[model samples]
Target: MNVSNLCVLTVTVICMVLAWSEPSKACGSCTCSNGVVMSCPNIVQISLRSSGLTNLSGSAFQNNKIVTNIDLYGNQLVHLPAGLFKATTKLQTLNLRYNLLVDLPDGLFKATTELQTLDLDDNPLVHLPAELFNATTKLENLYLSRVQLDYLPAGLFDAITRIKVMYFWGNKFDHLHAGLFKATTELESLYFVRNQLVDLPDGLFKATTKLETLDLKENQLVHLPVGLFNATTKLRKL
Candidate 1:
């Protein structure tokens, strides 16, 4: 073969070998027989949402370490096994909406430091472990609507300084503790609608100076604290 032809042939062989060594991205890595996973692929995203799963096998994500997104919405899961996400540190988005979870184990999210968005809406969770979100410093959007939360532990949000949008609608909160959002200075939108709150502390929004939208509709407020919006000069909606 000529030198030019020999160079082309060598390049083709190298390309083929590299392609075969890379993990498949053609589809999700799961082998489901009658709606059950018999084998899982080690890929970047895994979606088994609405699969009627009441429980997950402990080995569901056994050897898959590079996952970035997981969708577990509309399942019947009452609990997640501890360390379920320990190996998936690169995970960025997790959807757990419409589940039956009442509580999460302490430090459940300690390893998902790269997480950005988390949806836990429409669950029966009445409370969260203190500092459960401390490790997710990069989180930006959080959805906790209709989760039956009545109160939050002090400093619960101190670690999530990058949070921008948060949902707290349809809960049973009658009061909000002071400085609940002191660390969310970059927050833009906040939803507290349909709760049982009767009063708001003065300057409750002093830290959220960049807030643009605040929803207090359907609450039980009789009067607002003096100068409640003094710090939120940019607010455009109520």
Candidate 2:
């Protein structure tokens, strides 16, 4: 071919390649459309709750992945990818309420260190990793309501002392590790409603001097432990 023709072809090829180099839409926040989900961009929050997405594996939510909140409510999904939110490190909140999550990977939320609020309500989790919230030291609110927990591991939340409000309602808990709340001396509100607990440990509230509210309604508890509220002398109304 002539030199001029070859140069023109090279330029055309370069332009074509550039035009076809759109970024891969690996994953992104999505919305449900007519009972089906559709991918959308620039979404900061995604509410896929109760949409019945049984298997959330073939997702490409890694593309424009600037999401901060993801809701998978009332689904049948039992597993989550370990690094699911590693690409969305800027995320601050996550709501996995009312699902079928049985367990989570140890470092599942390590990338979301900025996460301040987390909700795992109404799931079927029988056990949770003691270090589940170790990396989320900035967490202020945590919800584990309506799960099937029978006991909690000792010193589970030792690293997160900044929590203000926590909910442990509607579980099958019979006993709790007393040292679990050692780091929660700054706690203000706690809920143990509708549990099967028979008695609290001796020093249940020894370190919670700042506790203000305690809702133990509807539990199978027959009596509270000695000095359970001694440190919490600020208890105004129960």
Candidate 3:
């Protein structure tokens, strides 16, 4: 083959290898007959979202204990097993959006200290345990939108430092604690739409100096907090 054709073939092989790099780690040992995984990949991420898998068993992740990102969005998982991710503690991003998870067990994310982005939106979680995000310091984006969270446990965002965006829309939050955003100095965008909050604390954006967007639409807020943008210099969206 000519040089150009040979080069094209090499690139095609690389692309094909990358497609199967991420193993199916979402619905392991499921009775839904999604087929056997056979082998767990040592790749960087695993995505089995919306795979029509009915039964979500813990053994599904036994083989792929080293993968970093695990996306199980839109699955049939009703309950998460405790220490289910203990072996995959090196994980960075975990997307559990649009699942059937009703309640999150304690220590669910404690082991995944390297975790950065955690998407728990569109679930049925009523309350979050304080220690749920225990030591995930590098965490950046957190999505808890469209859930049944009535109250946000205090100091829940303490360990999360690299946070840039946080989505907590469609919740039942009537009162937002003043210290909630104190630790998130690097935050940029915050979406709290369709909530039950009445008011926000004054100067809450002082600590969030990097904040640019704040979406609190369709909420029960009667008034915006005073000095809310007093410290926002680069405020773009509201």
Candidate 4:
């Protein structure tokens, strides 16, 4: 081929490549007043901390298929539209701390089965639906500190058996039901500090045999049940 023709072909190819590779549509806020949709095909992480967002539209995450991490900390989100994360199947880390969320839709994390770390601290979550964590089998760390969690349904953690670290500090629960951690036998570090627990049922920690560190400080425990920690032989700190 002639040199002039080759140069022209190269330029044409470069232009075609650039046209196909549009810039990512990642936005740092969801307070869209003009009905703008948030869709970014190639973005891997999104950080929208302290954006003053009060609500998220249902399609907030639609078409954002490849995102793996999302941080929405310190927002005023009171309710998340249903299926907000339905398309974010590749999500792994989600931090929603310091939001005004009181309840989350059932199966909110269903599409995020690969989620490993989830932080819901400082939300006024009164009810955590059963099976909410059913799809997050790979979850390793779960933070619920400073959330007004009064009770948890049975089998709440039945599917997240791979959890390694958990924090439930500064809640309003007065008692822990038996077999609550039956499926979390692989759990390592547990924090229940600054809660209102008065007592734990016998064999409460039976399934957490691999427990290494347990923090139960700042509770109203009048007495600990006998043999509660007998099964947790590897427990180093209490």
Model with the higher TM-score, candidate 1 or 2 = 1
TM-score of each: 0.83, 0.77, 0.80, 0.84
> Any runs in candidate 2 off by more than 4 Å, and if so which?
1-42, 58-60
- lDDT tens per residue, model 3, 1-238: 2223322332333234455553343223222112222243444566666754445444445444667888777876778877667767779889999887889988877678888889999998888888777688899899999888889887888778789999998988888777887889999999989998888877666688898998988877778766678887878998
Cα lDDT tens digits, model 2, 1-238, are: 2223322332333334334543243232333333223444445555555655445432324532566776666767687777667666667788888788888777787777778789999888888887777888888889999888887888788877888889999998888777778898778899999998888888877777888888988877888776688799877657
Worst 10 residues of 2 by lDDT: 1-10
lDDT (0 to 1) per candidate: 0.78, 0.70, 0.73, 0.80
Q: How close is candidate 3 to the true structure, as a TM-score?
A: 0.80
Cα RMSD (Å) per model? 10.8, 11.7, 9.4, 10.5
State in Å the error of residue 189, model 4.
0.8
Model 1 alpha-carbon miss at residue 114, Å = 0.8
| Residue 208 C-alpha lDDT in model 1 | 97
Error of 1 at 155 (Å): 1.0
lDDT ranking from best candidate downward: 4, 1, 3, 2
Alpha-carbon shift of residue 139 in model 2 (angstroms): 1.2
- Per model, state how many residue pairs clash: 1, 6, 1, 0
Name every residue pair that clashes in candidate 3.
28-60
